[model samples]
Target: MISFSALGCTQINGAEQNAATPIATAQPDLAISGNSTPNTDSPNTDSPNTANANTASPSADPELSTAIFAGGCFWCMEQPFDQLPGVVSTTSGYTGGTVENPTYAEVSGGSTGHVEAMEVRYDPQQVSYEKLLTTFWHNIDPLDNRGQFCDQGSQYRSAIFYDTAEQQALAEASKNEIAEQLDQPIATDILPAARFYDAEDYHQDYYQTHAVRYKVYRFGCGRDQRLSDLWGAEAPSH
Candidate 1:
């Protein structure tokens, strides 16, 4: 069982409410390794939902496409995609559940069936979905069935919510590849896209708004250490 101080984000943060004043940096601490080479490995045809219809904050630009992935805490999930070039915006949210507009508290309870997820709007012309998949795989522990890092519960389970058939195919291929590469069964789910509700305003960019607390909680939760242990050199910095 997870400890009181490490009961995912809420309880853990409550313990250190007075830690330090959060300082918002003008820029993210680290950037994703620029891999501009478009992934020809997967089919790139436009599907019905390929446009910005299914996700929150739909981009007016038709060129921008959205991809949703649940990789533990939405806080850690945003930074990786935010650092990438083609990504327009990353919204922390809850999805893959029956509830509508589920709150952080509800999801954190582990009964909403909604996992904390990130919705990434990016330009496919600049960064391919396959590249995003690569970054996602390297950042998460695909073999973990319970949850991610120190967070235990369905709310923190890793998942890929694909919006289109092409994405579904690519996701399946990538999952298979990763399973083979690791020689282990991956527990991350690849489900069809569901209604994604934007998390509370504060949760949008918790890492940025609560930098000090985010860092302290993240380290204390052993997120980075586990990533390094599981991913080795492939582990993402920041």
Candidate 2:
């Protein structure tokens, strides 16, 4: 149920002729565009390249570690972990797709099998994976399969890409806690971490660079309102 631009395959199950409604699939769709490499920018203050900043293995150093989570739009997802005390940086990217290196257009077109994701690099000593999980659950509607906010594609579905076994255990614990608290099933998946392709230059730090457009999009998309309805006081404050 994701809206797409620049393609004709709209609404996977539903047959409608419109640009906004793209077909959604539980299975990965084959991408014919072949492999395209994702651009890796050098680390900076606002956003650090996690690959350059930390361990080759995603398990993280005692000082630096990485956590990948897909919660709706990566634009909205980056700021939360970025503002955290020990968080080194957050990068918006794509994952859980069939394509080797997917572009935003390919993903948005529903051909890449990739979903919009955010990678958070943090210091383990200051902030535990548990805290990161807490932030994640509050920010997303785990029960929704249709995607997040105005976006309604499998690409935007919520997921947590855990890099290590410890992350998996903690993520499971957190999900159990949320399920008990909500007394409902949690739809978010705890999948193994995969290669995180950094999004395009313009897509990075979108909240800061495009402040007005970000706010307008956020407001229009109804992300805050939906979070409030779903989380109440538990919702994270902006």
Top candidate (TM-score): 1
Backbone atom clashes (below 3 Å) for every candidate: 0, 10
Q: Root-mean-square deviation of each candidate, in angstroms? A: 10.9, 11.1
* Count: clashes, candidate 1: 0
Model 1: per-residue Cα lDDT over 1-238, one tens digit each:
2132532354344232221234223124432222223222322212221222244434678889889999998878888998999999998888898765565666776767989899999999999999999999988999999988887778899999898889999999999999998899999999998888776655666676666556656766788888898888888998
List runs of model 2 lying over 4 Å from the truth.
1-56, 59-62
> Runs in model 1 with CA error above 4 Å?
1-58
- For model 1, give the 10-residue run with minimal summed lDDT: 43-52
In the predicted model 1, the residue pairs found to clash are: none
- All candidates' lDDT scores? 0.74, 0.70
